[model samples]
Target: MDNNRLPQETLERVTEETDNLMANYNKYVEQLKESYTNAQKERKEFLSSGIEFTKLIESEETEEKILTVYESYKKLLDDRTSLSKNFLSEINSLLSLVDQQLLLLESSYEPKFGIQTQNPRIFKTNKNNPKRLRNPEDADGPQMNGKYCICNGPAYGDMIACDAFHIEIPWFHMECMGLFSAPRGNWLCPNCRPSE
Candidate 1:
């Protein structure tokens, strides 16, 4: 039974899939850029009309007409904002799918190190950290999302250790990550939970 965890073959698949996803994402971004360019051109055309909508707004005689033009411009701005959000959400969903697939692949794998075992590291969520720190919202990066414990206390997802997304649950440390693979939200400290 292939568990579909992060086996070498699975890694290869992830690499391929991630590459394709990135390509598609890039294509969408290019289209978005094109949309921005078109918007700029449209703005230029509006200006070139020489109607001077700004002047029209100040003149009571054409205030209503000027307001109409302003509303149209506001609509375009709103549309662009909405389009950007949709594009971001689309890419985010694709990345999230890949993340889940990797988790499955990692679980299916049984390391050859004689100690064939399920994940032993279990993390608890420590909501206290965020409440204590007055730092920016990034304080809640994935590394800091786990419970309070020895490994999970500090040194979460710095470059010297695991990346934010790859950190083991609970503790989010390097050693535990090697031993018992971490589930998405559960992870024990490497010191507390030794790998087989």
Candidate 2:
């Protein structure tokens, strides 16, 4: 795939989806904050009312006033409990949505840069023409028929076989020649090139 030009539609769709998810996530966070604030406020109210009821009992206030204060305190406590339950339920929903969004994002981008494997190629080896021996003293000797490449290296990595009919050491490593990929049409090794 060309790095310069990715599929524009896919990029745009992923961006738009991510933005939408983020917006929803932020909204949920705001709701959780509001729920927490409301719960705290209810708790404070319940605590204050309990303090008032204790003061009324200690002062030997009228029975009717004491009962009224106690009832109000109980109602505040119930409201606090309900608010807590609602906060927990909203938290669960937010977590579930986050998990789903993660899954969606993973699935969306997996196909773009997923691991891919090519079937290995099996080549037939010739026992009669085994690999040439690599010895320091042999470097000065005449070129061996079994040896290959200008560097006299074994056939490994990316190499291009010369198309010339009567070329010596026909195979050349693409790296040694500073080539990123194979050239178009027939290619000749340095030894086979005609004089300028």
How many residue pairs clash (N, CA or C atoms closer than 3 angstroms) in each of the candidate models, in the order given?
Answer: 20, 0
lDDT of 1 by residue, 1-196 (tens): 4443347666677678678767866876787687677667667655644376554445654655545555665666777787678767866876787677666765554432112223334333343444443333443233433453344455333212222344343234334345434446544345444569
On residues 79-190, what C-alpha lDDT tens digit does candidate 2 reach at each position? 6566567656756765665555445444434221111111011111222444443553442222234575678765455556677888656556667667676677667777
Q: TM-score winner among the candidates?
A: 1
Each prediction's TM-score against the native?
0.42, 0.29
Please identify model 1 stretches exceeding 4 Å from their true place: 3-9, 12-17, 45-65, 109-196
Error of 1 at 50 (Å): 9.2
Off by over 4 Å in 2: 1-6, 56-196
Computed on alpha carbons, the lDDT of every model, listed in order, comes to 0.51, 0.54
Candidate 1 residue 88 Cα shift, in angstroms, is 2.1
